[model samples]
Target: MTDQFDEDTGDYPLVMPGPLWKRFKQTLADFVLLLVNKCKSSYVFDQRLMDGVIQLLTGLADSQVRAFRHTSTFIAMKLSSALVDVAFGVGGSESKEYKT
Candidate 1:
């Protein structure tokens, strides 16, 4: 008697699954697109916009624990700081204009 594994219909060793690296790269690229789109669409200091960006990055980080967790930490901190700077500058300028 011999064991048989069908390549076409049953479990097979030759079948190629999706590559993890490609998926990770795609997620990173999509994050860049989301960031660009968000920046281009608004000039207001809306909290929801910042929350959405953070959530998107966090979700990507969660999806690939080993490859992106550390990198995401750095990215999140830098982005948050940049957002704060922009918000402060805009608010300060707006208040000055009102005073003038």
Candidate 2:
């Protein structure tokens, strides 16, 4: 069975079944995480680069947060945790004001 859809009619295809589908999604997530980590490391020596990276990430998270408001709370929690982790890591907790 075909898993792809025709682009003209706006039709959707059936999702890949079982293990293959799981593996595909897992692979995609891993690739994304790898890219993010690379970017994070590459900006360590440049404050301007890090600010740009932080702004981009914040903008992305804002859009996702708006979208997630209608979805499951579990996903929102996961998103919140990830953002907090990044922010805390970037902004040291040495100052009490920085502690969330």
Candidate 3:
């Protein structure tokens, strides 16, 4: 997702933060939140599915392991909390914490 012109210009070696990247990240975060919010009691209680979610995140984060560590942790926490709420039959009562 790099620009050839930018690279040829010899401006920087690191990936530059651009609008498209920002939008893509926002889209990704939204998708993750949607997936997490869809967790019902059945999915929450399904050990296999929970493990899959964890594995998926870990695998994806492996690309930028160091940078994604905290982000992945936060996503994991939210997913866990959502699962717990659904399991406890309290999923309808949205918490302020999850809004972020």
Question: Which of the two candidates, 1 or 2, achieves a greater lDDT against the reference?
Answer: 1
* Candidate 3 lDDT by residue in tens digits, 1-100: 2222332342321223787766765665566656756755466557898788889767745534333444566566666665665545564455544775
Q: Pick the candidate with the highest TM-score.
A: 3
Instruction: List, residue by residue over 1-100, the lDDT tens digit for candidate 1.
Output: 0124222342221122467655654565556545644673373245787677678779756643433444566467656655666667678989999999
Q: What clash count does candidate 3 reach?
A: 0
Q: Residue 62's C-alpha lDDT in candidate 3?
A: 55
Native-to-model Cα distance after best TM-score fit, residue 72 in candidate 1, in Å = 1.2
Candidate with better lDDT, 1 vs 3: 3
Between candidates 1 and 2, which one is better according to TM-score? 1
What is the clash count of model 2?
0
In model 3, pairs of residues that clash are: none
Clash totals, every prediction: 0, 0, 0
What TM-scores do the predictions have? 0.45, 0.38, 0.47
lDDT of 2 at 73: 37
Model 2 stretches with alpha carbons more than 4 Å out: 1-14, 43-84, 93-100
Q: Scored by CA lDDT, what does every candidate get?
A: 0.55, 0.46, 0.57
- Over the stretch 3-98, how does candidate 2's per-residue lDDT look in tens digits? 242223322111345786667655645554454456554654467864665565555444433322222232334444544555676776456666
Q: What local lDDT does model 3 show for residue 96?
A: 40
